[model samples]
Target: MTKLAINGGTPVRDTYLPYGQQWIEDDDIEEVVKALKSDYLTTGPKIKEFEEKFGKYVGVKYAVAISNGTAALHGASFAAGIKEGDEVITTPITFAASANCILYQGGKPVFADIDSSTYNIDPKDIEEKISSKTKAIVPVDFTGQPVNIDEINAIAKKYNLIVIEDGAHSLGAEYKGKRIGSLVDMTTFSFHPVKHITTGEGGMITTNNKELYEKLKLFRTHGITRDKEILYNKNESSWYYEQLELGYNYRITDIQCALGISQLNKIDKFLRRRREIAEKYNEYLKDIDGIVLPYQEEYIKSSWHLYVIQLELEKFKVGRREIFEALQAENIGVNVHYIPVYYHPYYQKLGYKKGLCPNAEKLYERIITIPLYPKMTDKDVKDVVEALDKVLKYYKR
Candidate 1:
């Protein structure tokens, strides 16, 4: 197996301390193993159990589990009634799925600028992008930090728009004391290995609207409904089902849901450890003149999924690439969170250009995601800080 090396000669502290990782304990393994032993492996009791538990955890009335985050977004978009020629306002400083889901539904994605401090979608910019065709606003909770949901909601209300929060990074995050999943009309979560919790590969959509919830249930499974009561007026019979609309087979297995239930048990501990690591990074990097630490807004509680630091280019001798490579030489495992969504080839083909979102474009040039997860120890954190400090000193202007 290949190993990541540090400075050519020095060995990395841990060969597997990725930027983010799944913290699977014995319980998580046991749950999955137990599910495998059960008669129902897919579309079983555990899947519904996990959905109900997750819904309560996030304070949402309904939760629909799917194959992955992108599927969750697609389902949510479809349930929200997004269609061809519709426009959706969203931030560019996010994973492409936030915008691509719009395109998947034959809708146009209008890029919005980000907040300079939190790097979340700025509501003002979202408002400026709205038009007659605007249908929804999908604000990503970047790096586990909750976007300004109340402000975003105010804008959405004024313009009669739907809010589908891309909460892939914010399963346990809160905004203004309310959990993130409950704040918007719909919220999508990722259970990828790098997220706050993991189910190997899964996603979920949460909503309070019963109609939308029903629609999501159908959309996640080929729009087929087996509800006997809904299918027949009085002569409800077995084997009777209805294919109400078009949908996808985005159902997740019970094995994954079992693991998700197990992981949810330790979410508090996981979030606490992640925050501890983030605090350590903040303490160590606060005095560094050329680094801009992530700032949490007063009303939001972040899940600390990624500890991103932005470089002050004016104070650095080299650009982002040079610093990123230097960190890699030290086995720091640093990476950029995202390039602006509009900068992608597909979006450019749709008439998007540079300078469309000035704040997002500016952020792309400076931001880098440092190592962050629940398993890192104090020694690991110190080593990362020391390595970063050394690299910056060697390249300082």
Candidate 2:
């Protein structure tokens, strides 16, 4: 057998491959340049154009652009009327921002366990977490896979709670013959560099309810509105506007919107390439011992923002950290998707104890994020698989 890289043997590749990255084309740069030369940079025509196009893409009536994905979540929480004592249910196995948005509105973020197979928030756990204080459900499309939306929606309807789909990882993903944004009360997307699409740093919230749309817009722009009909001082001058409520300055720039528009134009092609890469990974990693491949449902189409794998620790002599380091030694840029949100020190200080989400905590111990982007070559995919096989086999008990 070939020697392991962790033992100072030959590595898989010379260059480091990141777990994720953005793909920028020439047209994307041209659009940004045009926006820079235009009259406005923050509140320009490009913002509206991007919003309209994004809304149409998701089959939603309205879309509000924000400074970042976290801002989008904050806007959604504000629009949902989250208050001091209200509780918003979300999964623990996600970025802190997913749950932090609830705290921003002075609401409590209730942690729900994830389904081991899909790494998504379990609908049954969501229902169990609901209480008299529950006001909204923020189910994340973890690893670009759509959560059980139909069941979550039914639960929300039964309890009269709002549904804010955290779709930061699933821009082009589909669910039950329809896109994700259209299926929830409010669905938020990210345009960070590593997301499915990039606007440098931006976010969007899509909704069918005009009321929610208006609230989202208000929250995005410091709770200010200049619309004649909604203005409290209708008889005031044309320049007059009102601050209806306290809000944040979460507006995204027009330059970024221009980039977003350009990126949006190629989302389909990018999504198709991502699916192809995922298929290749699935085929190569399926029979490998000491690993658990990601699971996908037949009915949904995943955008695959991340390609995460779970190490079968029992089959290996060393722990997860050792295997992770071994893969890195092989020049494979591997990273962990998350450590449960509640596991953070801040959450612990706020009285959130460990063991709240057993499945998420357990999964966190074995999960590692592998490279998955549109720009990756087939050789890059193969190298990643071979590196995993080598490390896992080397550490096999």
Give me the candidate number with maximum lDDT.
2
Count clashes in each candidate, considering only residues at least 3 apart in sequence or on different chains.
0, 0
Task: Please report the candidate that would top TM-score against the real structure.
Answer: 2
User: Compared with the true structure, what per-residue lDDT tens digits does model 2 show for residues 1-397?
Assistant: 7787888899999999888899998999999999999999888789999999999999989999999999999999999999999999999989999999999999999999999899999999999999999999999999899999889999999999999999999998999889878888999999999999999999999999999998998998889999998988799998889999898899899999999999999999899989999999999999899788899988898989999999889888999999899889999999998989988999999999998999999999999999999999999999999998888878899
Kindly provide the TM-score of model 2 when superposed on the true structure, using C-alpha atoms: 0.99
Which regions in candidate 2 have their CA more than 4 angstroms from the true location?
A: none
Q: lDDT of each prediction vs. the true structure?
A: 0.89, 0.93
How do the predictions measure up, each by TM-score? 0.96, 0.99
- Model 2, residue 346: displacement in angstroms? 0.2
